[model samples]
Target: MEMESDFYEAALFHIDRERKLYSSMPSRHYHNGYEIFYLVSGDTCYFVDDKAYQVVGGVLMIINMNEIHKLVNSSGETFERITLEFKSEFIEGIFPDNSSIDIFSSFTKGLPMIKLSGQEQGAIEKRFDTMIHEYTQQPPGYESYLKMLLFELLLFIYRKMESNPRPALNEANLVHKKIFEIVDYLNRHYDEQHTIGQISKNFYISPSYFCKTFRENTGFTFTEYLNNVRIKEARNLLTHGTDKISTIAESVGFESLTHFGRIFKEITGMSPLKYRQNYKV
Candidate 1:
C-alpha cells in the first residue's frame, strides 16, 4: 500500500480468526512505521524477515521499519490479535524527549518477539481496551489520554522485559539458534553477494546442512530468501528515494539490471520506475 500522510498517524486493529476464513494469505509487507503486534488468543506462526516463529497467546511481536513480516494461522482453533502501528515521529511529537522509553530496544537488537505472563498480559490488555474506547468515543482530549495510556503500556512492557530475562520466545534447539544467527547476518548484509557455500563456511557448517536448515526454518530456499530481502530493500528505495533504477539494483546486490528488472516485476507486478511513480507519495 502507498504511504499516505493523512491515512492514520497511528491506529489499532483487533483481528479475530472467525473473520479470516476467506482472507487470502497476506502479501508479506513492510512499512515506514513501527508495529506492536499482540496475540490475544490461539496460535500462529510469525515470519519476521527470515526466521519463522511459533507464537502463542500473550506473545507480543514487535516490528521496526523495513522489516518484512507476516502472520499465518498455525492452528485451526480460534485466534485473535491487537496491533498498534505508529510512526516514530508521532511518539516523539507527544513526548519531546521520548528516548527514555526503551520499549523497542529489543526489537532493534533482533529479538522482536516476547512472551508475557498471564498477569502482565491482563495489564497490557486493559490499557489497550481503554485506548480503543477513547478512540471510538473521540471525546475531547481523547488524543492526550490515548497517548498517556500508550506511554504507560510501553513502560509496563519495558519493565517486564527488564525483570524477566530470557523468555522462551522461540525454539530452544541449537540448530534453531544457529540458523537464526545466519538469517540475522543475511538481513544485515544483503547488499553483499552471499552463497550457501560461503555462508556455511563462515558458520563452520556443511553446505548441505545449511541449505536444509535454512529452508526448514524459513520456508524458503537460501537463494529465494536472499532475493526476497534484496527486493524488499529495492522496494523501499523505489518508494521513498530519488535513486536511479540501476543504482538501486546494484546497491541491493543484483549484478545484472535485466535480472533485477525481471525479479522486481515478478514479485511486485510492475517495473521499477512504474512502481516508484505509482506509489510515490
Candidate 2:
C-alpha cells in the first residue's frame, strides 16, 4: 500500500498467511504513527525495540510511534493479524486536551501485549467492525465518527490495561540492557554516521558479536535501522515544510541527493517533492 499522509487517519485489515512459509522473515521497520497489532489467528515471534515476544491469537500489541519492530515467522502455522495505525496528529486532533491520558502508559518499557478475554475480544472486534463499515461507507460526517470509534477502541484497551496490568518486562540480563542502550544511542544519533564496528566499540563488544546479537534481537542490521530512522525523519520534514529536498536529505544524514532520492523512492514509492505535494497540510 502507498503511504498515508493525512493528519487524521485510520485503517483496518485482515491478513491470512496462506502463500508463504512461516519461516519467511518479516522486514524490520518503523513509522511515524502508533500501531495496534491484533493477532486474529496466528503465532509469530515479534521483535520490538530490544526484546522478542511470542505472540498468539487474541492478543494485541501496542507500539508507540517510531519504535522499530518486525514480526518473524517462527512457526509454520497459519498466521493472521489486524493492524491499525494513526499519527499523533490524529489523536491530538480528536482529544486536544486529553491525548496524554489516551496514550498507552510507558508503552516503550511496559509489556505491550494485552491478552483479551473472550467478551473483551468480542467488544473490541465489534468496534473494529463498525470502524471498517464507517470507513468503507464514508457516509456524511464519517471522519468525525471514525475518530470517535478510534477513541472508543483506545479507551477499551486502556481500561483493560488499568484493570489488569501486566508485569513489567524483565530486562535484568546484561545483554538486553546493553542492547537497549544501543537502541537509545541510535535513536539519539540517527542523523550522525553509524557503523557496526563503531557501535560495537562504543558498546564494548566485538563487531561480529554485535552484528549477530543486533540482528537476532532487533531483526535489523545497524545500517538498515539507521536508514529507516533517517527516512522517517525526512518524511516528517517533507510534510511540514517547503525546504529544498537536497537540504532535507543532508539534514537527515544522506550524503548526496542522488543517494537520498533513491532511498526515498525505495521506501515511500514517491519522490520527495511528490510526497510533499501529496501530503503537505
Estimate the overall C-alpha local distance difference test score of candidate 2.
0.65
lDDT of 2 at 90: 59
lDDT of 2 by residue, 206-278 (tens): 8988776665444345675566557767876998887899999999888889999988776566788887897
lDDT of 2 at 229: 57
Local distance difference test scores for all models: 0.67, 0.65
Clashes, model 1:
0
For residues 40-139, what per-residue lDDT tens digits would candidate 1 score against the true structure? 6444667777767755455688887767776766444445677777665544567667666665565576767776543455467667768778877789
**Model 2 regions lying over 4 Å from their true place:** 1-25, 96-106, 168-281
Q: Residue 79 of model 2: what lDDT?
A: 58
Question: Of the candidates shown, which would achieve the greatest lDDT relative to the real structure?
Answer: 1
Q: What is the lDDT of residue 108 in candidate 1?
A: 74
Q: For every model shown, what is its TM-score relative to the native structure? A: 0.52, 0.50
Clashing pairs in 2: none
